[model samples]
Target chain A: GAGVSQSPRYKVAKRGQDVALRCDPISGHVSLFWYQQALGQGPEFLTYFQNEAQLDKSGLPSDRFFAERPEGSVSTLKIQRTQQEDSAVYLCASSFRTGRDGYTFGSGTRLTVV
Target chain B: AQRVTQPEKLLSVFKGAPVELKCNYSYSGSPELFWYVQYSRQRLQLLLRHISRESIKGFTADLNKGETSFHLKKPFAQEEDSAMYYCARSAGGYNKLIFGAGTRLAVHP
Candidate 1:
């Protein structure tokens, strides 16, 4: 794809429900990242992947937040037992190398936990 | 330990007025800073990086290591420039970015 792509632009989940968001990064991009943006706040790093290797997961807020990039091209972010506090927009970004190359961001998935 | 702070939640200015968005970061080591902008209903995108020292859309940011600041500035604001701006710092071998709360710029005509 010419740009990073995210699926299910908006989602509404009930409390305790599990939801999964998807991201398709630019072709052959070597690094992918996941971020969460709460209302009125900047995007916060959730996890990072160098190719298919999950090199960092330090920013994931809790164990309920899990992200995987099995093939390094596409990634998935899964939230288990969603809570009201989980409502936010989830963004996916990919870079050609690392931070020096800058990043292309997806439109993001706005999840509303009701 | 890596933190970015954008003190202003909103900044309003008339078109053609000068604009400056303040940003500050706290990191012991040398940091890579960037300014990202988001137009209404648009995805966030990079505006400029301290390393690049380039201006985009008439906006420029200079990193001040002594004060730990990277402030975005424009000579004349444009109506189309109204958007949300974020200041970010790369950390952990440039693997991740820590972002500030963001500042909303309203360039009115």
Candidate 2:
């Protein structure tokens, strides 16, 4: 069985540049989540989606960050005007019904902002 | 806000010795806890969940509501057990896992 998968395993962006990361969750999963992990730190919540509906995005660090899960299966995280501080690994995970079922995570996209 | 604390950043033990990686959490309401492990050059994977109460890879963790802790323990640590371990918590339907900084355990023969 396929697990959650991410694209562009690695990316390097200059300061102020825009970048987009993609995530493909397990089939039929209703809940999808995105997290950002800085160097030597644990993953931090960024946004969440249940089906095509974005239930919460409070974890997005700034207005420059945006995420969408239009079909409830694929998700894209876009960061506009990236800063050096934004350099981190972006991880995507999915579960059956949010809190009830365990989540399966992808290898993640390591974005390095210069 | 829910938070997880891993007292040690790194732990080193002999391959045949007992291993214990501590985890503590703080949340106002009842929250589910979990232990996730990441091997070198591999993606992070779930080790165990408090609700399931099952052991994996000879490792076990018990949630102590009184102490607000869930510590991972193995009777005889194996060299394969060396990896990065993270403690996590989930509250409500958020599906947002609050994770600790993580602990790196190294087992030597």
Best by lDDT: 1
lDDT of 2 by residue, B3-96 (tens): 8999999999998999999999995588889999999988888999999999899999999999999999999999999999999998656658
Query: Per-residue alpha-carbon lDDT of model 2 for A16-112, expressed as tens digits?
Result: 9999999999899889999999989999989899999998898999999999998878999999999999999999999888755578999999999
Candidate 2 segments exceeding 4 Å error: none
Each model's DockQ score: 0.82, 0.77
Please list the residue runs of candidate 1 whose C-alpha ends up more than 4 Å from where it truly belongs after superposition. none
Best by DockQ: 1
Q: Model 1 lDDT vs. the true structure?
A: 0.93
Residue pairs whose backbone atoms clash in candidate 2: none
Model 2 chain B weakest 10-residue run by lDDT: B89-98
Q: Positional deviation of B20 in candidate 2, in angstroms?
A: 0.6
